[model samples]
Target chain A: MDGVLKIFKFELHNLSRSKWVILYAVFYFIITYGLFQFESSQSRVVVSLMNTTLLFIPLVSVVFGTMYLYHSREFIELLLSQPIQRTTIFWGLYMGITIPLSLGFVLGVGIPSVAYGMNKLEDVKVLGGLLTMGVFLTSIFVAFAFLLSIRHDDKMKGLGFSILVWFFFGVLYDALILTGSFVFADYPLEKAMLFLNFLNPIDIARTFLLLQLDISALMGYTGAVFSKFFGGWMGMTTALGVLVMWTLVPLLVALRIFRSKDF
Target chain B: MKSVINILLFSCFVLPLHAGEITVHPGDNLAAAITLAHAGDTILIRKGVYSGVGIVINKPLSLVGTGWPIIDGEGKGEIFTVMSDRVSFEGLEIAHAGLSYIKENAAIKVRDVRYCTIRNNRFRDNFFAIYVSNSHHSVIEDNLIFATVKRNTSTSGNGIHVWKSDSIRIVRNDITGHRDGIYFEFVREALISDNRSEDNLRYGLHFMFSDHCRYVRNTFRGNSSGVAVMYSKYVEMTENVFENNWGPASYGIMLKDINDSHIRGNRFANNTIGIFAEGCSRSMIERNDFADNGWALKIMANCDDNKIFKNNFIGNSFDVSTNSTFSYNTFENNYWSNYTGYDLDRDGIGDVPYRPVRLFSWITEHQPASLFLLRSFFVTVLDLAEAMIPVLTPAKLMDARPSMRRIL
Candidate 1:
């Protein structure tokens, strides 16, 4: 535990000192500020932020995470030489990357929105949900980066695979879902839609955005589905659980991979 | 006892000689006074709580209250049953006609009468506030009706309900918490204006089989559903505000099986669907503003020959969603907020026709659960691609002359 903390603290210090992290924060701040300039309504701003963050966060996290691992191969080797536990180093690296990214996001989006002042409780909830979605996307993609790195030893291959995964989630998966819905148009697919959304973190985040931005549109659906998906606590908790699982399952698999990999 | 004897003696002798105003205090026998009073005479009621009067007017009479006297039903029965023509009720707080599934216990029920006037009254906690049935040329105006139901249910009654009536003028009323704010059935030639109906259990204004009606300057907000005009003909709805009527199957105006009507200059906002038209034809829906609704218009496949023009569609989730592959109605000269075409020719109309219906909208209409993919990246790409080349949505549904600015 102490070894993990030490590694985590050191990696965090190093990443915080890096210029890329600062740039990330600045980019997010600009995006959020521009959104506020265009729309004074906090909910609308939050919705736009959800859209931008969903697109950018996954792409940035995956590419950056893979690049960071490949570039720091030597440093990781040096840490491996130490007697520190592999689990400790794994946790340390994970926390180091995730915390800075989340902080950058939270501070960047949070400062402008908090400055705007959330008068409605609903706005505050949506803002919180948006930030949570941002952080979860970061963790999930970073874990995917680890999985890609561990699975592919070559740097170029690892980077290519990272980009491919990002594109697949961003475009192809949703296309397939849309087509699947169309192809199976004759069947009732409400439960299937819910299940499919649970399978993709990006889909889950998009669902979260729609839960607020298009509530009336959602209500235009049948009554039972809306009540089950949005009007009750069960749906929210399930969505949150799926997101947590998306982060955890990847990280755990990456940890298992790290444990047995031969450098 | 002595006062009662003197009143009886006066009623036996003096009442027969002349028809005059009858003044009754709180403790006086209001029923005996009504019996002794002549037709065309006014019963002047003093300020106090009177319950279970069960007053029935069989002749033309006026019940005028001073200082706003209370006529409570005590949750048992209907308050007034006017059976005669030329009857009027004024300046009273009538209340507590309780729930009865059998009899519609209204504060005032004008039945089988003509030329009745129900004005300047406040009604509370009644099953039906003012029920005008089988009447003609009646005027119901300047009244406030409120009920205690938190939401719309069939058990709750309407604020002002008219059935089998004609030439009725319902104006300047504020109603809430009832099943429907105003309801008309089998009525004709009615004018409903300047009413504020909000937070009702059901529709703010619901009419069926009523013809030649004109509704103007009314505000219907936060109801379970908004105004529903159905099976009516030659109706004119102008300058009304339908807002915050949000729920599944809720619409600002649900027009069903109607013909030859004019819906002009209305503002519809924050509704699930601004206009849901089915089996409607020959209607002119013009110069209306639709903002922030789920779907601005859901014109079904069954509708034909309707003209939708000069409307401003702003910030709606979907501009138009229909179950039709072919556009039956004319959509022209509307200003859509999502229109991105350029006007290099400097014409107010866009050089390119704007397609209001998206392929995704059509898809969602076909499969509702697919709406989970709304605003997703892939969906955006699909929409963008579809916009560049129209494939699934109706081809002829495009607005041939899209406005460069809002149609003010």
Candidate 2:
């Protein structure tokens, strides 16, 4: 446990010094403020931030995290040659990168959102949910990046792969389901569509934020179908649990992958 | 001059006139004609292509055009303006105004008026068809607005644009070949119903920050995107038909940050994606029919606790696509074309819980290209395995209160 703490502190200090985390947070802050100022509607400002943060926070967090892992490859090698076990090093690095950057992420989005929420105290629940969501989602990306970094020492390739994964999960997953549904139009596949939503992490994020916004009606038929099948507390908890899975399962797989990998 | 004599006759009520009548000829000034007209007067333009400037009204007046009178801005100035209470413009064809993205230049502009009506006008080759700003209690219905759509650049013009307006009724208008069919920004308490919107480069209906509005019985067909409603509340969308909106990322209705609304009795068919619901909550979706969509509904997993009940799900390839399970929602009494559950006891409700989502959805959500591995035996086996074991998909995402019979 002492060794794990040492690894954790080392990685945390390394992540804090990286310029990319600061850049990412700064850009996020600018875009959030710009959108808020442009649209005077409070609800709209919150929604845009919610969607943008979900996409950007994860993307930037993963990139910086993966790059950090690659940059410190020689240091990791030296440490591995020393007394530390692989799991301790991996967990330490994961916690180190996630904790500091997660703090930065909160400050970047939370300050403006809190300021906005001051006027609209009714939206405290939404603001809390958004902040919590950003933190967990960032952890997911950070963990995924650490796992990817373990495979390749090349920062560009690792970053590119992370982006591709993000794109597939973020944008293209929904497109494929839609395209396949069209390609096989004759098939009676209503139930299949419900099962298909769990494929993308962004969808899960969207589900939480959208439910909070209270505008699921515009989702039309399938949203209606989902509301029918999973419109209760049990259904919502299950949906949220799936979101946690989107974060945890990948991290776990990445952890396991890192555990067996040779430096 | 004969025009001056006619103007005097028009003002003196010597010529035959009803309600309020003013005539605009090439030789006469439109502003002068408007100045002579009183409250509840009709400004009639003769059958000639006149290239005079815009006409502004400050009273309850009707601007009637006879024989498709053409109003050209002459490339030097603005086209027209209606700035009074209960102002109406009809039966005129307007074209050729300078495009100004900053200053909204329209063929007809209605500003800061109450109870104004703009109908039965044909807009061709104009920067903006009908632009209403800071106006209220107005009706813009049954106008044909066609603007040039370019694939090269984005234009800020719309067929019918309403901004910061309230209690406006827009209905039965055929808007096509424009940047947007109908657009509302920061508008409230309006009703947009029974409009046939088609073949626009952008969304059929694009409105943001507009609240307490109702879009009912409108056919949003064959646009780049059917309709996009973002960041609003208490909006009722019922009995609208969303069809034939196809693209790489197209949907019948794209809703973002909408809350506490009613989406009922709508028909979604033959769109790339029927309805894309993101970041919405506590909405009541009931009695809508989903048929032949590429994907019926794309529910992003963050959405929760919204009731989806009594809807007919027919022939969609993938009914509900999300990254989460159906845990925090209630899906009951919905008729799924793919529901294989049996009503064992002769009651209308199904005997067992129906899992609307399949294991295939979970696989595709994580590994999208695995979609190319579609129809393989591995997909089926994996799906069956997951269904039997229930590992990755949420355990409680099933519909325990499944109805045996179709509600609709």
Candidate 3:
């Protein structure tokens, strides 16, 4: 545990020193602040910010996580020769990337929303939900990136697969759902659609944030079963559980792969 | 000076001598008192509950209550039926009129009465609050009508119902929890203004075959199906607010088979469909604000020669949707918040024509379950692709001159 903490601290320090992390954080802050300034309606701002988060957070987390894992290969080999356990090194590295990315997101969007007087109880809940979704997305994508990096020996293949996974989840998954519903238009597809929504992390995040916003247009479109489920606390907890699974499953798989890999 | 003093003495003393005053107490029979009273007499009812059913006042007299006198109909029949001209009924609380499939019972019924006024009354738990049939030049104002029982449309009656009534003025009334808040059938030259009608089973206000009528500054909200103006001509609806009439088959105002009308300066918000028109022709729908509705305007194929211009369409899911192929209606200079086209020359009109219909709307019209894909990124992509190559949507349904900024 002590060794994990030491490596985690060192990795966090290294990430803070990188110019790309600072630049990414600054970009997110400016874009979020610009959106709030441009639109006074908080629901519109939440929707626009949610779209940006869903698209970019996963992209940045995957690419940055893959590159960091690849560049740390020498450092991992050096630490393997030392007195650190494999599990410790793995968890340390995972926390190292996830924490900073989460913090960057919170500071980028959270600060601006708060400064703009999102102080109402409902507004605070919406902002908190958005920030939480962003953190979970970052962790889940970074864990997937780490798994891809450890499974592939070639750095180019690792980065390519990371981008592919992001594209599939971020964009193609919705297209496939759309097509499936269209083809099965005659069937009672509500239960199937709800289950399919659970399969994609981006969709889960979108549903969670959208439920908080409670825009009537979107709510009117959601099926009665889905609305009944996601409109209450049980549904919220279930969604959060799924997001946690998305974060932990890839992470545990990466840890297992790292345990037996030849350096 | 001497003639003026004599005229004042004659007006005060002689008027009272000719028009006698009859004071009816709680235990007295109101029908007997009304019968014994002469024409132009005043029957003042004291503050007490009077259980009377089918009280017919066939003479021209004034029925005034000092306090709000309670007239309970005991669920039996119509409480007060006025069959004479120049009658005035005011300051009464009428309740529990009988419900019948045959007889159109009401708390107060004015039948073929001319120059009558029904004002300042409270109607409770009545099948029909005020029913006027074949009555002309009557005024119904300052009344509160509330129905306690919730019934289906077929079993319920309207709050204020007028049939074959001409030149009637309905003002300053509040009605709720009825089938239709205010209904007019073949009522011509009617002025309905400054009334609030809400939360009814069907339309807040319904007009059928009513011509030359004008309704202004009224508010209709939270009703099941909102207002309907059908088979009417030369009807002017101005400055009314229609809001929160939300359901699958609800609308702020549905105009069907209406002609030569003007719907101007109204606000429609949070309705299922803001302004729905079918077979409506030669109407001018201008300077209205439609906000946060499912569809701002659902103009059907049968509507023709209507001009929709200078309206603000804000935050609606679909600004304008139609099932028509050919377009005779003109949509120009309306500010649509969803328009992404640019006004490069800065003329405040978009350089490209704005098509208000979307492929998704067409899809939803066919398969309503596809509405679940609303606001999805893929749906947006489909919309953009379809906009670039218009195949499914009607080609002629485009706003030729779309305003760049909100008109109001």
In candidate 2, what are the lDDT values of residues A1-263, reduced to their tens digit?
Answer: 88879887876676667766676667667776776776544655675677677677777777878877777788878888887788788778788888877877777777776665534656887777777778877887887787677766677888889888777766667556656776766675655765776665565565566555533231333344455545568767777787788778777887787778766
- Ranked by TM-score, the better of candidates 1 and 2 is 1
Each prediction's DockQ against the real complex: 0.46, 0.01, 0.28
Q: Give each model's clash number.
A: 1, 56, 0
Docking class of 1: acceptable
Q: After superposing candidate 1 on the true structure, give the runs of residues whose Cα lies further than 4 Å from its correct spot.
A: A1-13, A16-18, A38-46, A114-119, A223-227, B1-19, B98-103, B149-154, B345-349, B404-408
Provide the lDDT at A242 for model 1: 87
The deviation in Å at residue B37 for candidate 1 is 1.8
Residue B17 in candidate 1, Cα distance off native in Å: 11
* Winning candidate number (DockQ): 1
By DockQ thresholds, what CAPRI class is model 3?
acceptable
Off by over 4 Å in 2: A1-263, B1-19, B26-28, B74-77, B148-153, B404-406
Candidate 3 at residue B17, lDDT?
86
Give the Å error, residue B174, model 3.
Answer: 1.6
- Residue A199, candidate 2: C-alpha displacement in angstroms: 26
lDDT (10s digit) by residue, model 1, range B1-408 = 999999999999987566578998898877678878899889899999887447788888888889998888988888888899999989888998867889888899999989999889999988899999999999998998998755338678989999999999999999999999999999999999999999998899999999999999999999888889899899999999999988886889999998999999999998889999999999999999998788889999899999999999987878998887788899999998778787889889998888888878977877787888888878777787787788888888889899988899
